[model samples]
Target: WSEPRVWPLPNVWLGVSTENQKWADVRIPILLDTPAAVRFISAEPLLGPIDLWNVNGINAIEPDWIGGPTAGTGCPHP
Candidate 1:
């Protein structure tokens, strides 16, 4: 048996949501390894700080877009 391979798909976008460095560190690498036309991070409700520039001591891999909820302009909160 052979390991599964991931291939880049047309018009496919992949993303992960991270509120802080912890989750970013955990999820970003996996997202980077996956094949996607575009990769992004959603920091909605940004509960804490995150540093995408340096994750897992690697100075590589960055999301195509990093977006978060703008003050009073995003999804309604309870």
Candidate 2:
């Protein structure tokens, strides 16, 4: 069956994973625009830094949740 045209499905939660700023920049916007009951970001195995507040230079949207390793732990610094 084809995907539904109506977005922001009632029960489905959508998310994107990013290892660093580069991928975040590439993926986050797409995820935000696509509709879902909930939206999230996964920064697991974080290889570098990311500034969610500054994404797209517009500060237009924010994820419902952000998950990843704690600071000074799994994530590495530049």
Candidate 3:
């Protein structure tokens, strides 16, 4: 999907899972390389903000927009 976004909209959107070995997490770089006018990241299901050790890759994505991670936890207090 790195073949330069062909979409009419200049904005590009991506969802990155913080969990290691996930396809979305690994593919973000290639998507970032697309040269879209704008880029954003959806952190839903974030699995908690990823550790700095693995943050370098995410920085490269340079997301233009950000979203809160979807809470995986269910209702509290049984």
Candidate 4:
């Protein structure tokens, strides 16, 4: 099982533009649901604001830390 984020290090950071708002919404909880100490959301690629049903382990929700059309594209257009 994945470990939860420990204090002094923000946890549960998801790339907003990795796919879409759905990506952040769906994945955020999964990360928080982990047995981490302190969970948070990156909310990067802030195309727009989002709202979640519940944030179990999430302690903080950072504002637009990531963005752009192809923000978190790992390999690039290869």
Candidate 5:
């Protein structure tokens, strides 16, 4: 489904899944191109460390918020 063109909230949130380094690598580019008041990633069930420092075509993409490892392994958020 396509997102609504109009949002009533003052800020809009957009998220991408980052369950693994490879997944994050694939989705980061799409996140970078999409517009949002705050871009975020769902790092739930984090399988491995995510190195935003390096990825092909990765353009310093930074998430406004990242949430969860949800696996009960440890605190993924602080």
Candidate 6:
């Protein structure tokens, strides 16, 4: 008989991405619907401004943390 092997899992249960507005707009909803312990989005090295004002997924999940280009990085949110 063969013995079964155990697989290791990651400590962080969050999903991470650096998607731009268009991609994020489409994919965020799907990620939100998925069963994850946490969800995260990173706008670092951001190409342009992202308007999340009307993204229902964000409103529903209300993520604990968000990261992106800050002051002096020349990338600002409008």
Best by TM-score: 2
Weakest lDDT window of 10 consecutive positions for candidate 4: 11-20
- Model 1: lDDT to the true structure: 0.61
**Candidate 3 lDDT, 15-47, residue by residue in tens:** 344332364557667656655545444443434
Give the best candidate by lDDT: 2
TM-score of each: 0.59, 0.61, 0.37, 0.48, 0.55, 0.49
What's the true lDDT of residue 17 in model 3? 40
Worst 10 residues of 6 by lDDT: 57-66
**Candidate 5 or 4, higher lDDT:** 5
TM-score of 5: 0.55
lDDT of each: 0.61, 0.64, 0.43, 0.52, 0.60, 0.51
lDDT (tens digit, per residue) of candidate 5 on 1-78: 497666424466776767667888798889767766666666655666676655443323333343554343432354
Give the worst 10-residue stretch by lDDT in candidate 3.
57-66
Model 6 C-alpha lDDT per residue in residues 1-78, reported as the tens digit of each score: 297633223344554444357766776778678655446565544555556666543322222233544443424533
Pitting candidate 5 against candidate 6, the one with the higher lDDT is 5
Give the Å error, residue 33, model 2: 1.4
Ranked by TM-score from best down, the candidates are: 2, 1, 5, 6, 4, 3
Preferred candidate (TM-score higher): 2 or 5: 2
What ranges in model 5 sit over 4 Å off?
1-10, 54-78
Write model 2 residue lDDT over 1-78, tens digit each, in one string. 496556556777677777778998899889867766777777765667677755532323322233544554535444
Task: Name the lDDT of candidate 5.
Answer: 0.60
